[model samples]
Every structure is written in structure tokens, then in C-alpha cells.
Target: MSNYPKTALVINCGSSSVKFAVLDPTDGHVFLNGIGEALGLEDARISWKHSGGEKTETPLGAGAGHDKALAFLVNNILADDKALLDSIVACGHRIVQGGDIYSQPTLIDDEVEENIKKVIPFAPLHNPAHLLGIDAARENFPNIPHVAVFDTAFHQTMPPKAYRYAIPEEFYTDLHLRKYGAHGTSHMFIAQEAAKMLGKPLEETCLITCHMGNGASVSAVKNGKCVDTSMGLTPLDGLIMGTRCGSIDPSVVFFLCERLHKTPQEVEKIFNKESGMMAVSGVSSDFRPIVAGIQEGNERCTLALQMYAYRLAKFIASYYVPLGHVDAIVFSGGVGENGPTTRKYVCSELEEAFGIKIDNDANYKARVYMGVDHQVISKPDSSVKLFVIATNEELMIARSAMQFVK
Candidate 1:
């Protein structure tokens, strides 16, 4: 352990993309970050950066899943710096589904890895990709430790009522089908940072943290513990996002099968990939284009945008009752950090209901970049505070790794 680099390698593997980050464990400083994409259903492309501000990109292989992509990513990113790779004492993987098997970041071994695989049925789209990332990293650095930093770990504090559906208890007891919320790390990081900016003790801040990226989720944090969250068992169960149709009635699946004549898996593909604002406005998933159309008199885009805001506001307001008096609202992730109009829209309707309000001018200007400072969007007299906090889950992982290295 003393000989290994005091650095930790972090991997976040999505369905089509693999994002890697290297951080100094002692200080949680990101040395460099990069992504590899398996786009167009063809050969994969890889890219990475060095701390010297040098970046490199190339093709790794074709049509391989995340595991192969991970191997190729290491080859291109760390090949020139064998010493750096050797210094990576641990690998922290961002797993989408932790289920009841884990409540925090756990060191991965043969038994732990097998247990993670057992939860695959609970998160079919996510768990497999995570395993691939783990295997790839282990294959390259077999002696190093690998830890699973679950997206659901931070929400493990959710009490039974908040997590359990109104369905039969047998399903939960026997099949473990209860809600295991995702995006917990993002919610935890954003909420704490927002509370810090407001000079409030994190445990005293009753916050609603919106992690709105391509995948979106809203969490209700009262005193630093997640009480309730928008995303249910999967990332697909939140507000309408880039490609996911969030919070649809369960019966919609039957409608897809009977009325649309599609099988369950086919319908799953639609909700996970083709639906949401893209399907509603008939525009691209990237909100930039959809927002541009808003200025071009596109009624469909306007309606889609309205639905997005209305849905987000509804959930945020609903949690106010469960959380008691709200202290601050925090926004993070791709859209939440940069989409001021979206954040503004979500906050506007809540002004009358939850005493929530934000300055549109500040929001638009604040979003010039994601990691910018805390901008006070709330009015001086407004009871509730609103903020944009940049989340750093990679650093969180590195810090967790440090706790174990000694």
C-alpha cells in the first residue's frame, strides 16, 4: 500500500459512454478526466487527458461493451504513464444499483462482486455495465483494490414508508423489489455544498437537491439524511429527462403491449432511450436545441418545456410537506448546473406555493459554467434559499478510498 500511488481511479460507465477520472486520494484533486463513447452502434472511440493539460483521443475497438472500452481507455490514458497507473491504489466504481446488499462504498472481492451481480435483475440496464467496468479495471490492475460506490448508497437511510410501494409485502420480502433510489451520491454532494454556501449546518438544512442531467432525480434531504427522493428503484422513475419518460403510470406498459403491439423489452427501450422531451417535442435530447426552439415559436417545444417544469415543481413542492419548513434548494448535474431557464422554470411556480423564488438574470449568468461559485438566486426576503452547487462524486470516491488504504 505504501508503494502504490496515493491516487485512485474512478470509473462511471453508462450504457454508451465510459467516464474515467484520476484523483489524488490525499486531497481529492482530480488529476484528469475523460470519456470513451460507443456511439452509432459501431466501433468505439477513446479519449483522455493528462495533468499537463494534454489530451488524446483515438479508436479503441468496435462494438464492445463497457468492459472492453474500460481496457482500451486505460491503454490510451495510462499507457504513457505506467508509474501513474501503478500508483492507483484503488478503483472506485459508480454502481447504479446497490440494493440492500450495500449501504456504503464496499471493497469488491469475489464474493462482493457476485453479490452485486445478484442485484442485476433489479437494475438490468445498469448493474451489468458496472460489472464490466470492474472486471476491466481488475484485469489491468489485479493487485489493486476495487470499491463499489453505489448511486443508491446515500439513500440507504430512507425509512421503510418512504421506500416501500403500496404493493404486496411478499414482493419486497421475497424478491427485494422495494425502491432503491439512484443518484444518492449526487444528491448528497449537492445538498451538503449548498448548505455550506448558505452558512447553515448541513444537519439543519431541509434541502431539495435536483440532480438534473440527461438522467434526472430530486431528493429531499432533512438534516443531511435522504428522507424521500423522486427516483425510485431505477433512474427512469424521476422527472421527465433527456430520453426517459419519468413517473408514468404503471399501466402504460400494458398499453404499450396491447395498444402499440410492442413487447415489454421493446417498450423498455422506448422509455429508456426514445421518450421524454425528445419524444414530446420531436426534437433532440440535448436541451440546447429544445431551448433554442422555444425562441423560434415552436409550440411543441414550449409545451414539452412546460411539462418538464410543471412536473419538477410538483415533486419539489410535494416534498415540502414531508420535510417541514424548507431551508434551501440545490441544483446540480448537467442540466441543473447549466440550465438556468429550466431551474428558473422549476422554481417559479413554487414561489406561490412553497415561498420559493429565484432571479432569472442571476440564473442565466450563473450557468455560464457548471463549477462556478454559489449565486444567490433567491430574493432577499424570500423564505427559501436557492443555489447551484457543483457536485464532485469522483472526489467523494477518492476520499472513501483513502479511509480504507491505511
Candidate 2:
């Protein structure tokens, strides 16, 4: 076994998959990472890799689920390396919605699990899966502390003016119908890294961070806290996403349900599952295929790409209201870090409107392939700096979990 620093086991559990990693919180050194996929299916399987090692896969028996998959993770994978298992100081679980109650990572106890259960309606698909993973991990690693790192935690700092909708006061007070932004973990990580790149303290930096992926959100951070963000009540309220309809008029839902004779659930499925780039481009939700279609002269695909960049740029520009003196505009996530074409379109829009210059050569070269974790994409003389900072949510989770290690 290699010499390893104290690490945290980070778990991001979904309905059918559990992504896990063991990483040192100090320098973000990953010791191992893997996933338990296709849980509860006939082909339920687990795949993993030790640091600097080849991937190995194993198939669990038919109908295996979270409990069984985590059992295999503990008994088969982690057990193989005694030192690695011993180095685990804590377990961190990523939770999607913590409501207004949890503003920071909390030590997981019976009370915390109960609190997660209370917010089930806000994140029906994610919180239960997280609880399952938490239960399984706690069962396996009984000696170590378990912490909950919420995706909504960082955005909880948003003031009432930012989070509250213009609805009736009773609705917000009684039902909690307020914005609870997602991707807080990614936003927080990028903000910290961007501050480091800017050679300033995080508390002194003002940034508009855009995290664009299959699911996308932009946040405005001023003086080290979230002042405002693009996403709202749910992730579907944000900028256009792979399959989600971003911000649409409320009447559209009524029009579809009342006039077109569709149920609320059906309309929800249409907006959440059958919209965005897929509906716009008549191509796959994946940007790669849409780009290919654009190359082949598909107008729909061209419109899709244009809409994606335009909507994203508009969100970033809007955040300028909250962040008066912007230190930088950060682009991170799958599409943000890798898609130079999208970045060009977005930065161009900002340039025309706000004079945020984008260096064509620098923007083209700043990407995952270039092996730079963070790089400025804007010209030196630009009014506001632009950056392509790769986000690391797992490491952030590990760091949060580390806080409870003692």
C-alpha cells in the first residue's frame, strides 16, 4: 500500500448510481474513485480504480442495490488495501436539497437524517438516494464520523430579497416556496480557486460564476457569500439545461395543463425531461451531437447552441446587479471548461454589452485538454476578468467532511 494522507470517503448517491471517492482534503489527492451503477437492476455492477491504477469492474448478483453495492465497496474494494481503509477519517455524503434549515455541512446524526427526510418533497429523487447511501456508509464505517454536504448550503446565504419569490407571504412561510439553488458545491469550489488565481482573499472578491453542464446554473458571489443566483425553487428554474426548460412563464404550465388537456405531472415531465436542447435542436440532449448537427447545417441545432450561450450570457450579465464591482467571471463544469465555441459566443455577448473582452487565442486554448486547472481567458486590459476554472465538488465535499473528523 502506498503512503496516503488522511482521506474522506465522499459519496454522491443518485437513484441508480453512487459515485464515490477517497481523497485527501489537504491537497486534493485522490487515493481511489469509483461508482456503483445500475443498482437494483439485473446487471448491477461496481467499478473502481486505486490511485494511478487501472480500472476494475465487478458484477453483483441480480437485483442488488445500494446496500449490497456499498457492502461490496467496503468488503471487496477497500478491504484489499489495509492502509487505504485505515486512512479514511470521515465519510461525506452530497445532498441535493437541504431546504432553509441547513446552511452548512452538518455532522450526520439521527436528527440530521430526520431533517433530510423532512425536505423530501423538495428533492424527491435525490434525498432518498442520499439517505440510503448515508445509511449504508454509516453501517460500514461505524467508527468514522459522517457529514452531510448539501448542494444548496452555499446558496442559503442568499438574502430574502434574492431567495423569496413575489408570491403570497403565507406560501413562503408555510410551504417554503423560495429559491434553493443547486450546484453550490461547484460554485463554492470555483470561487475559492478563482480567488487564489486573482491573488486576493475570498472575502474581498466579487464574482459571477457560471457552471454549465447537462444541468447548469450561474451564481453571483460578493464578498465571499452568495448574493444571488440563476437557479430558483428547483434546478428547473435556471438557465436552459440539457433536458430541462429553464425559466419559462408560469402561464405556460397553465396553458399546457388547462387548455391542452395535460396533467400537471405530464407538463412537469415535458419541461423537466423533454425540453431544452433536445426539444430545440431535434437532436440528442448531449451538446456533442448538437455541435455535429450544427456542422451539418442543421438550423435547429444552431439555434440550440445559440440559445444555450445567449441564455447563459444573459444570466451572467444579470448577476452584475448583485456584484457591483466584479472581480472576475468564472466558467466551469463540463461544457464551460471544454466548449470553446460556447465560451466564445458567451464572452462575445458580454463584450458587446459590458466590454468584458475575450482573447480569442486564450479562450480557444483554455480547456481540459490543455491540462491547466485554471486560466484567465480574457485579455489583460479587460474591464472584468474572465476565467476557465475546473471545479472539484468531490474535493470540496472531502474538505467539508474533514471539518468533522476530530
lDDT of each: 0.82, 0.92
- Candidate 1 — number of clashing residue pairs? 1
Candidate RMSDs in order: 2.7, 1.0
**Prediction 2 global C-alpha lDDT:** 0.92
Looking at candidate 1, what is the lDDT of residue 296? Answer: 97
Q: Which stretches of candidate 2 lie over 4 Å from their true place?
A: none
Q: Across residues 1-20, which tens digit of lDDT does each residue of candidate 1 receive?
A: 12335798888877788789
